[model samples]
Target chain A: MTETAPRPTLEAVAARAGVSRATVSRVVNGGDGVRGPLVERVRRAVEELGYVPNQAARSLVTKRHDAVAVVVAEPETRVFADPFFALQLRGISKELTAHDSQLVLLLTEGRADHARVGRYLAGGHVDGALVFSLHLDDPLPELVQRAGVPTVFGGRPGWGEGTRSAVYVDSDNRGGARDAVRHLVGLGRRRIAHITGALDQTSAVDRLDGFRDVMVDAAPGLIAEGDFTPAGGERAMGELLERCPDLDAVFAANDLTASGALRVLRAQGRRVPEDVAVIGFDDMLPVAEQTDPPLTTVRQDIEEMGRLMARLLLRGLRGRGGEPGVGGTPSSVVLPTTLVRRASA
Target chain B: MTETAPRPTLEAVAARAGVSRATVSRVVNGGDGVRGPLVERVRRAVEELGYVPNQAARSLVTKRHDAVAVVVAEPETRVFADPFFALQLRGISKELTAHDSQLVLLLTEGRADHARVGRYLAGGHVDGALVFSLHLDDPLPELVQRAGVPTVFGGRPGWGEGTRSAVYVDSDNRGGARDAVRHLVGLGRRRIAHITGALDQTSAVDRLDGFRDVMVDAAPGLIAEGDFTPAGGERAMGELLERCPDLDAVFAANDLTASGALRVLRAQGRRVPEDVAVIGFDDMLPVAEQTDPPLTTVRQDIEEMGRLMARLLLRGLRGRGGEPGVGGTPSSVVLPTTLVRRASA
Candidate 1:
């Protein structure tokens, strides 16, 4: 390892290039409107001195860091255990790269990290933020609002006071759940059971609403609570079976939950689609396709949703003309979902 | 939505608090030696005015950003599709959060993005970098090396010149592969086939060497190329069966590839552990446990690897004592791997 010399500044570059400070600054900014000879000399001086532009100084002038903070508020590891967040992040990364920006990831553990995140956001280190998986009653919305940075939430946030004015991007969870239940109903299956995701998230609540939109008068024991994990799904399925053994169909909130239900059903000797039909949300090909009988699932464009979030934030940024919103709102978008029929249903 | 006010600066806080600029700076930078009354006055003024201390100005004085850049140089999306990288990132995030440092993610698509990453590291926006999934002949190592940032590669970099001095944290790929093959051999399965991940990657190459270490002089027909994707695993399985139909066991480079092989074997009516056996590296629970009859795979502590990467970098950062490495080298670490026995074999 070699020792690193102190980083060269604009003044040093100017001194080395035998040019004025303003000339060096103008050249470093873009080299536009500068003579070819002078630009070449400045470039040579910068290369010789290994002068990497100081972001702190540049940000002071430009009010931009070319960075966006992606705040994922998932305390549990199960969400990351699957590809859900990774896919969303990949989408966000692609869009940010296309726009020549960087992603600063802030993973929040719980209430303790919230203050840290709030302080970081308020510190003016980033131009905007793209937040994900915000739970009901989460203080992030209000904190971000107070910070005054442009933000786009991943899922539809739990409707609470002060969050109505917030902008977000989400999949049509309720509509997708409705379609899954409708498809099952059309298959002539009655006594349908619904497995719900963790109710803390708005997606889970909305999905439960979709399930009810179809089975409005379902039996009391037909609904089971799952935490969108295979283990949670397995336990929920067991509880549902104990309560309602005659249920002919199951609608799981997500593919992972559906997988667990399938495992338990297989263990209970209930053949899929013959004795019990199952449909799941989130086409999530890897899990959906690998199920004993390939899962019939509702497909939401997850990556597309992520891309839309970035696009929406970028649009808001442009609309504000490089200023944080002074007195206006950014519209939210809800992408649609479609049923992908497979062997299970 | 309400209009946002321009952020208040240090001068504003100083004026409002009726203190000198130096006193306000001292208060904002932690109030180490400031009087309690004066500090309280400055704090009240900052809160009342919603002042955000300029990171640019602070960094100019302290020469630190308290951020680490995590560079994932994977062009293919397959790795992200599974929980491999996600689990690793989760561990990294936990460690970084405990240290009160932020994570700045730099995902590179291909050769083009390498230059951008190089420039960013050179620009001194981050204190250190943790790079992942570097392939053979990749120029990122050289670029990062020249940038002179204290870096720790996630996996072992290709043995290129100038990379011998690089610090890294990796799993015992060869040892894990050896354990998997040994487990398969212990089951009395003759004519075992090998499914290698992308040979471009050092992990894959090392695993192949391990397989060769066990099955010295195995027939060429038993080896098939896979790009660590399920689809690639399926294709490789098909080709291996075509070349050597009697091959009784397989050692896939990763879990995703193993899942594909399991699918193909089931489709071909070859019962697992009866006529054929399968072993996979990376005991990625979602894929490993969900596979039909579960997977007998080698378990690398992925999350621990990520944690160690952050810890190693943090150690290096602290050792440098806030200076950019005045010529001291950090030792590399390679964690051990264990074979997890399950129903597949």
Candidate 2:
């Protein structure tokens, strides 16, 4: 039964408190110029009237919008459906709120949208930018850096071509992939096929390299590629089955892809574990639990990746610059990936 | 082979275009006095110099932040893991970009963070606000409305107690649930147990009501409640199994819960669709395909909901201070849902 209410402004608070507008501003901003008695009065007025300072006004003086943009280079549909991205976004949002900053999300998958995004980011739209899921030779890193804004990448740049070093946080993809493939070999699978993510990304390339390093001595000639999408996994599985029919097991780059491969295998009348063991990366709960026979996969701490990225960007915003030299702890982190065993592989 | 680059500025663009800063501003803003030829010249200069305007200077003139805040009233962990919220965000981000606005995300699940979010939103930090997952009696709607900012809700308010008449875009929860249950009944499923979402949400209440309304005349003593989470579904399912050992079907409030219920049924040696038919709401792609024996569910167009919400909010923002009846239709929109039948049900 609340009535229509007028919003309380700073001027209203100042008038109610019997003080000047400057005095109210000083109190609201916690400046040292305000007297104790006046500050107490202003606080009382703010509480009573529910006066909230306009963010636009504050940004005019501080030049800080108290907002950060999170740009992900993925398809719009994938961005929404991918739990990894969602978890990271949640983590970033939580951390930004603690610092009184807001997180702006931007998806730049379409080539046509790139120009528009560049303009938005360059136009003083946000205080900083956090770019995730970078591919080799992406122009975004260079574009953001040249604009003179503080920017952070969510994962390490695979190409290693940018002049301005990027501050990034990433999982130990190489080690995780190695561990997964080694586990398959240990399970006595003589012929193991690998379903890889998009090769343009370091995540895909690194995982493939790790698998190859393990297969060099144990099993070989069972590698295929996918675009980290379910459909792509299904297509890749079809090709793999056609080429390597005797493959005893498969390792997919992600859980979505693994689910797709499982569907394809089942359609083709293959029994899980007994005939063809399957493993996936990114132990997303829904995908892992619902996959036929469940999926034994690799797990990445996606939430931690988000937290570390936020912390890194905040440090850069505070003028800490990039971490020291090359191989000087890499200015990037590689979190460990654990193997989660289930009925499938 | 890139070199250390300097940040672009209005001065740089002016110098490159052989124009004054005032002329450059006019071109950048598409101000009235600018001629077409000169505007093109200035644009080319901006492109060449990669000039990004200083946000502080822009704020001084426009008094707009060019940003909107998307607040999720859920924990950071769940916000990302939940596909419903994630897809909504994705749709919102796309629409905001089309309107040339930045999207700022906020998570206010923890009680300790609520006050901070209220202050931030109230502080004029964002031009508009989009809130999702409102529980009954939540203070955010009132707080935002009292701030005089345009606010939009993702779902309909159940209790309807707030001062602000929120413009919301909701899925047809009632109809979708009815359709799901009707399908099960069409398959001759009596004693159909109903697993609901959180009862506090209108969606959960409406969906449960839909099931009961259809079942009361057709069948009785076949209702159970779940919290719409997978674990909640599993637990509720276990309880329901004990209560009605002869139940023939179940209608879960969401895909996650249905997936969980499927797992429990499998563990209990129930043959899906043969011994017990099961249906779920929110036809999430992974859950539909990956659940053992697959799942039949209701599909709510998540992306469309997001797009519609963005369009509505944009209309509201444009029609500010005018009559609320300007947007061709009432601010509230309820989109229809479809039944997607698969193997399980």
Candidate 3:
């Protein structure tokens, strides 16, 4: 009931501190003009009054919200379902908290919402923006850039050749995929089919390219593409089976796709590892464990990726220059992906 | 680069509109008293000059942030891994967008961070707070209440005898559990075993109580506790098997627990449905399908729960006074939970 009472104001605090409103404002703003003893006196006055500086007023002067918006260019369902997003979000939250900043999560799925989001960011609602799961030609990048707001991407944008510059943190997709396929080839499988992810994403393309690089040398005839979704994997698997009936093994772009491939293989009465060995990427723990005979897959530290993304955003917020282009200082940090060998492969 | 230029101030808009500063403020605030032609003239001037009201300056008067903080007490890994949280979050996000508000996601796992969160909410960082996955005797509710901030719990708090009231949206755990057990009993399962969620949660207690209520008449000696983690389910299953070796069926608290139970049952050489039937709750789609022999479980619309929570918070924000006990009228919305039969039971 008492909470419904009017909130305390800065003027009230200034009155209590026995100082001019301008002096109190200077102390509250952390401006250097306020002396040490006077600052301590103002602080004591603040504590006694339990006064919180109006964030809006502070933001007006500073032009900083002390908040970062993470814009996901996907549906809310996909953003929530993907472990990658969750992990990155955790990192961002943690880093922002350390700096006394708030994390604002925005999902730009529908076209109307997309425009609304663009306006919100442009209207100075947050200090900077971090974007994730971008497609080849998302207008968000250019739009935010034109607004003069510092923007970073979670992964490299799919389009634009020659040194596209946006600070990004990505996993070692290319090397990891190459290593996964090389392992399959080492097992002496000649026909290694691959289920790709959404072609519009750089992650999917890099992963597919890695698989192809190894296959072109090891086995020329075993290449296939599938969307990252499980159903996509299943459909692509069925197609691959029809096209290459004798294919001895398959590499999936992600765990969801791999799970689908495994189901299709089981449905077709193919013995796992013996008749058709299977390997999936992004060894999401639960999915990896649930698959029949488990799943042999590539493991990327999703939490670390999230943490790095947050760090990059934080560095940008602090105006720490010299980020490695679109990929960050390293251009792209390729976190090591290890193979977790299980029954399927 | 034009965006980096200082935004046009309210004073500029006032001058351009040939009006007093208060008139310009009233127009920007959408306050009553401004006439139609003047309002239209002021609006056109605002559009012409691309004048966006400074949120910080406005907040000093309004004391509202137009932001809501969503606090997840669980760790980042759990938040990301659980489909339930993600689905609920999506619902909340969608609703918040419609209300033209921002959402701040806070994960309060660490002790230091928890205190920081308490202070942040108390300091008027967010308009209101929505807490999820609260454990029994958690001091957060009391802390936030003492801070004079309106707070809502995702589920009912576990401690006390319902003396503390907070607006909550929850599934009918009792009815869902009863339905699951009753279905198994209808199928002539004499030795039914219940795998419950963590005892610290109200949902877990309600679910176990429901199972006990149905089994009290049919088969009384069938109950086991699980922490809602897959590993916890496995341990609980092992214990149940040791105590009730002839158990013919199971009703797990959640899909993860059910999956674990299924794994353990398979390892113990039990055939699903044919030999030992199983039913899990919280019908997470992918996990339900991935379970060996699949799983029959209780399905609650997680997204709807999220939407309702957001709506409740928005209502509180709008001063509509429909919220139960805390600010306005308290309503306990119990959504229906349905049973989906599959290969498991």
lDDT by residue (A76-157, candidate 1, tens digit) is 3644566788778778878877887666676554556776677767655677888888777888886676677888989987
Question: What lDDT does each candidate get?
Answer: 0.83, 0.78, 0.76
How far is each candidate from the true structure, as Cα RMSD in Å? 4.4, 5.2, 6.0
* Candidates in order, interface RMSD in Å: 3.5, 5.0, 5.2
Model 2 interface RMSD over true interface Cα atoms:
5.0
Question: What is the C-alpha lDDT profile of model 3 across B1-345, one tens digit per residue?
Answer: 112345567798889989888988998877899999889879988888767665545656666666777887676668776787887888888888788776667664344456556655665456787777877766666555544566666876667432166678889999999999999989999889988898988999999989988888544446778988899899999999998899999999999999999999999999999889999998887999889998899999988888888888777666644335555544667899999988999
Residue B80, model 3, lDDT = 74
lDDT of 3 by residue, A160-230 (tens): 43116666777788889998988988999888888889888899999988987887764434566777888
Model 1 earns a TM-score of: 0.84
Q: How does chain A of every candidate compare to the true chain A by TM-score?
A: 0.93, 0.84, 0.88
Better of 1 and 3 by DockQ: 1
For model 2 chain A, where is the 10-residue window of minimal lDDT? A321-330
Q: What does candidate 2's lDDT look like per residue over B140-224, in tens digits?
A: 6766666666777788876645534667889999999999989988999877889889988899999988987788763344566
Best by lDDT: 1
DockQ of 1: 0.30
